[model samples]
Target: MGGQDRESDAWVYVVNSGVLLDDAFASLTLKRKLERGRVSPENLPPSIVGRVAKADGPTVEAALEAAAAAAPVWGAYPLETRLDKVGELLCRRLTERAEEITRILVAEGHPVVLARWQVSGMLECFGPESLGFYRSQMHQEFRHGERRIQVRRCPDGVVCVNPPQNAPLSSALLGVTSIMAGNALVVRAPRSAPLGVMYVLHEVVRPVLEEVGAPPGTLNVVCGDPVPLLSAWVESPHVDDIMYFGSSENGVRFQERCLTAGKKPILELAGNDVVVVWKDADPELAAEALTESFYGSGQLCMIPNQVVVHPDIADALIASLVRQVGHIRPGRPEEEDVLLTPVLRNEKFFGCLRDALDKGAELACGGHAMQADESRDTAGIFLEPTVVVVRGLEGARDIDAVRHETFFPLLPLIVAERAPDEVLLERFVAYVNSNEYGLRNSVWATSSTVVDTFLSQVRSGGLLKINDSHIGFLPYLPTHGGTGLTGGVFGEANYPILRTSHLQGVSISPGSRPREAVFGAWNALLPTKVPTAFPTTFPTKRSQEF
Candidate 1:
């Protein structure tokens, strides 16, 4: 009803006072308005707003200055103490506000149930399990002569986080880990998905930041277009590290900018993940796993884009998948198990679907768009759980639909001849290993050997699962990123304790030992220790021995 007028309005949030202010980006309202129905069919949700005032540049600079000034004090905090106070408090607050947060997510187009789970996962990211992971990597000890040397963990100061629009809260969780590692952060949340992030920051993180005596500006969340904020942050000499999530193209560009500015960047970019089903794979299990391949409308970075199935069971697997997919009902955000959000329901996304159909891809099941509710007449961005049987991966011209990360729901199945189980598995492993995107991979196999081979040989993905659950991540697993374009660096496991800090090697010498004492342990184990003395010093002894 208010769609037309709302499309012309924009909301911005900037930091002022000691807390987040709603009118931070008010000036930008004239430049670009926040469109309610422009993306989703919902009304403008309540959130913190920032005004694009020219003088506001100093605010961001001040925030960074505060974070940098506070870094040493925050970084020196005991890991256990920080985990107990800040990490534990954040988790508890999230649990307390779970329902309220889920409703905001639903308002933003995410299904209610899935929204709750998303919050749950965020909470678990700060829980004991994640804390244990940090603890394991925090301290190292080794014996030296009569004393022991200890290696301690250190935090990288002043981290800047730019979360993706698809999963703002979850992506924000990735940034929270920097705090656990004792690094202060400045976060730029997606303008389209600010409500969920604001809710989490206000209800969960703000209190923790205060209670833990975290320095002012240690954790700041600004809501606006990320381009300006990121450019400013990256160019600034104060900002130490930046953690980003977005398209590969943008990621590469961001990396170049950071390098040009002489800054450090950790990018988590796009993915064209693949799933390989061998001849021995069970059809039923493969069907179940297919849900993950298309969940969140296949919008998640780890969601599989292509399925390479053995030709023998390809038909049966497609049939079973079709049946299960049929049960994947699209409904209003209030409905249960309605995972997809009705954003980006435009020609760009649907055009890819149409192009794929025109290119000789056989639709195994869903091919048309569906409405969230018949009465509303306002359609959700729903694409049927499309299963296209292509002769080969090369047959589909809309490869961008399956190859690049399209934040939409589309499933494509590719068939390959069944060969020796070993050879087939090997080929599948090699294909996954060779992929440019390395976020996550799923394999549905009955053979332990097949699973082992995949796990050992598949070098691309950050996480690999066998005959197991997909999409749903545990606290212990690093859920955020991977190698290649996925992050340009390996290891995006969601444990904040690990994500927030860097592995620092510190040697505490009880007494200043000879430099060789550090390398003596290894040298002692060798069959013949390389003589430290120079040839000239041991000339007589060497001559006699020779």
Candidate 2:
């Protein structure tokens, strides 16, 4: 999924998959440049449209305004009613447009099957699944003699969302949870990945907003330089909360800017996820699971970057991993099973791999960029899954390839000496949980005790998986963020509702009463007048003076 060539036309019409946009299209276009070279005249495949729009500014702003205006009415309606209109509409529209959306995604850079799965998951999350979770959150109860209060979830007004560029559909789903939670949103779509959201908003959300009488500014979408948009939103008095997904370096900078501007920010940042392979782990299963860590060219925040394996099974695991690595083939985005996208396959990734090799890391399997057998212009980005066997953890430490995140297909495998299973497990857990960046962690273990130990000891990541798929997640299970650098303030748990709302405690009384009197009795029991016992001190002082 590489970038599209620049268009030279002033008025560009982005269409859905297989749908060409003529002048008759009803979609809104806020800007029209007329200069001869103002805009590049490029014929972009529909699949790449979703990723390309992340950089459009006017489009995002308009969407945000619409969402903001609609928030009050949406928040005021009964949860069920709101779900029926907005959530249900989103789901239905997504289903109807799934094929087109998936096609667009494939054109942009994803495998068709993966694109379909991405769109399908987004639809399910906005449907009954999300509605049920929100309804459950609405239930209220109180103990005897306690104040009976309705835990009203009020909208937080205007929220700004910055979606990740890699998984455009999934990133939008992460942001949609906040919208479902009653917050009006101004989403900054991945400038490069705008088609998916465009289809969702234009086909699904717009109709719901119009039918349900959502306010004019309830939701908006913009694409452009994220820094300018984020800066403007953070500094704007109208924007109440900001949800961001990006690298830790970028996330930290955003957090600082928000603090400076006196705005609240919820961040989902980067991670160097760690996967541990124990002696008893299934080598075959472990090898299969490792594929997820390399998916999307290892650009995802949850992809495992380093593997710590036990020596007893390390040799076997390496063999299996290398064998499986050979099967990952590079192809066009429309290919049904193509797993990798052709983006960022340049000197930078090659440089990183070369540096790793120079640092004494052994390349166990694949380690080169593959060009498709097609027009050079259409060659897809393909990197061999390069696995590096490190001498030890000490040698791995401080290595940029191991410590930092690189959006490339590079895996570092560290083999540890044989020890008690319990000790090795504890050490592995500690290492994963101790990293400053905590997004996700995966472990391969057959022993229940080892699993339990890992679960208990691992504390950094937002999500933990035991013998299961890493990136495969459900709607109820938040798939976006984590702690520390991962999500500075907003965690990637099923708490989008919380992120989009503020809390306020209220109490009521039937009659006017002295505010201090309510606690006066308890206060009086302490000591109203405690006299210091003199014990004839005055007489003793007088005698001493005499």
Top candidate when judged by TM-score against the true structure:
1
What stretches of model 1 exceed 4 Å from their correct place?
Answer: 1-55, 374-381, 393-398, 489-500, 512-519, 522-546
TM-score for each prediction? 0.83, 0.81
Instruction: Rate residue 204 of model 2 by lDDT.
Output: 66
lDDT of 1 at 190: 74
- How would you encode candidate 1's per-residue C-alpha lDDT over 1-546 as one tens digit per residue? 000001223444322211111232452342244332233324433442233222145555666776787777778888766666677777788788888887777766677777876887787777788767666777778876666667767787888888887788878876887877788877776765676676676567877877877766567766656777888898887788888888888888888888778777787788777777777788988888777766666777777777888877898888888888766666666678776554334566667777777777777766565565422232444666667787764444346565566656677787865567667766677667777777878887777788788877777766777766666667677776677778765335334445556666656655754755645656678727676423444457777798
| Tens-digit lDDT string for candidate 2 (1-546) | 001122221332333322211221222121122112344435544322333334344444444555555666667766555555577877777788788877767655677767876876676677677667766664444532333545556678777877777776677666766666676767655545566665665566656766776555656665556777877787676677888777788888888888888777888778888888888999999988887767766767778888889888999999999888766655665666666655444577767778888888888976666655422332335576678888676657666778777778888888885677677777777778777777788889898888888887788778888887777756666665577677775555536666677665444434434554355445456545532222444566778898
Alpha-carbon shift of residue 475 in model 1 (angstroms): 3.1
Candidate topping lDDT: 1
For model 1, what is the error of residue 92's alpha carbon versus the real structure, in angstroms, after optimal superposition? 2.4
Clashes of each: 22, 52
Look at candidate 2 and tell me the lDDT of residue 542.
Answer: 75
